[model samples]
Target: MYGDVDVPAAVQRALTGFLDLQQERLEAIGPELTEQVQAARDATSGGKRLRPAFCYWGFRAAGGDPAQPILTAAASLEMLHVSALVHDDVMDSSDTRRGAPAAHRRFEALQRARSEVSGVGGDPVGFGVGAAILLGDLCLIWADEMLHTSGFDAAALARASKFFDAVRVEVTAGQYLDLVAQASGVSDMDQALRVLRYKSATYTVERPLHIGAALAGGDRRLIEALSAYGLPVGEAFQLRDDLLGVFGDPALTGKPAGDDLREGKRTVLVAYAVDHASEVQLAEFDRLFGRPDLDDDEIQLLREILQDSRAVRACEDLITERTEDALDALDRAPLADDTARKALADLAIAATSRQL
Candidate 1:
């Protein structure tokens, strides 16, 4: 089986080639739309492309070739993800992403520069956020278009499209639940896991695998098996991401340290920390958890508390357990090809083991 960071060279080359083709297609859409499309497409530059890789391998596992149309459709899903992130950052008002200025922030700077040149602008940040939203919407439309034109059979197209649509709804619902949970200070670990499963796992991993399998005309058994593997891996992936948000090196992650704390994300890790902390630690956490004025020293102290309380260790143990379950699922899955199965296993490790 492939290990973490051991993506096959062929897969890497195919993905790169697919991205180039998609970028060209995005740029050729129209002059008026080209700039926005390009901006949206460029926003994908820094991501790990895990979803598209999953789709590609899932296709292979279901007995499909990694050729033009299949790979193109797979790449389109990446664009869809990128579009979601662009809009999400705007909505979250995140200043940085992928260790640099977020798309909205970049666009805000552009708007300010244009305003200075043309003598027009009330609030550049607002204008930029609006523009980024529109651009994200455009990318979503084009993602569907690309999928439609991807040369799959009608049945395959319908199946994949249906899954993709369902993913959108599930993810949106998850996001809604996440916001509600955070606002209400509902720290139930079970509720937090549900939010993670629906919002992060189903869409990020399970549905994408199912979509790929559907495109290749896989049976229901195979689809269910893929989901079985995907759910745990996907949840683990997001859980690792939450850890990174607080403890990850800012240079690697392309964001300020303790961003999740600043945003007050009600992740499972945070909930566990709260549950396990002492009265003194709880007092400190309550004072600083959602405070925007937290300094580096305070964040460091919070990290220490999380470690001393063993929440970090507990979270890591959960990640390992989930990953092992995913691996076991993959092992028992009736994959027709060994290479594809190995690739999928490798992907799970990479998704969960990243530091950034």
Candidate 2:
């Protein structure tokens, strides 16, 4: 699926170089800025480079040659992704990320320690939240900066910038929609799906492809085909994630066990379960699901209900259906060669598969 390009390795090198340069600039500000830069470095570490892979392949499929500028620009997508994750962790009040303390949690812990020593900072959690918000904003700005400084000519950058801008808006709107759905405590499939498409579908896959394609000066035909392939794949990707969030090993997922259940994520699976639930099951589900203090037995019981409701099966079907749709579209896309098509097909499978 990777073709000749080791996308993850290449992006890692690019990110390392970029962060090093960023650190130099931060040094001019103050030595105390060391932690901030380290925080950024840590956040960018251990990513699957999925977004960057999509961006790289999109450029490749559009007939773009391997170039240094593209690598830096692709790495910027990771910055954007990291930005989203930091803010998302804050929003979800997640304790861990990538199997370590979440950005906000890290900051909170730092503040708590400092407050204990000096007795200065009040409300350590709030301090952590504020710091994480700044960190997310910093990454967001870095994403734009990295792209603009990627050494691409103005024309190509201009072309790609449109999609980059659009993706930012789409992901933010999607996140807001998700927040609304969770707060409303309504498990409507249509609403959940809307949240899915906007939150994950467009930003994660479709726009990354579009940005890369545009950078390569690909025509509207190529852009449409990429979306035709990318959107369904993106939806399937999130659907798989929904299942994992509920049922997968927390250690593997780098999240608290049943965190999604505790948070009451209004995913399509949840919607399906709710729609098909019996009266007594609904009552129990409402009582136990989303309770922050739900015990192990309650968690197991929720899992059983999800399984018995057949929502898991429905979600699995949707993943298969969307993956097939993506592969079909990729087979028909006007890619530069068969290699790109095969790589894309491979990515589709990886995105929708159960593996983390």
Write model 2 residue lDDT over 1-356, tens digit each, in one string: 26678888888888889989989998999996777789999999886787888898899899988764687899999999999999999999888998899999998898899999997878989989998999999899999999999889999999999999999999999999999999998899999999999899998899999988888889999999999999999999999999998888877888877889998899999999999988989899998877878788899999999999999999999999999999999988999857778888888888889467
* Candidate 1 per-residue lDDT over residues 241-330, each given as its tens digit: 989999998888888989888777888988888889999998888778777778999888888888888889988998999999999999
Whole-model Cα lDDT of every candidate shown, in order: 0.79, 0.90
Measured by lDDT, the strongest candidate is 2
Q: What is the TM-score of candidate 2? A: 0.98
| RMSD for each of the candidates | 3.1, 1.1
Model 2 gets an lDDT of: 0.90
> How far off is residue 295 in model 1, in Å?
1.1
Candidate 1 Cα RMSD (Å): 3.1
lDDT, model 1: 0.79
What local lDDT does model 1 show for residue 156?
86
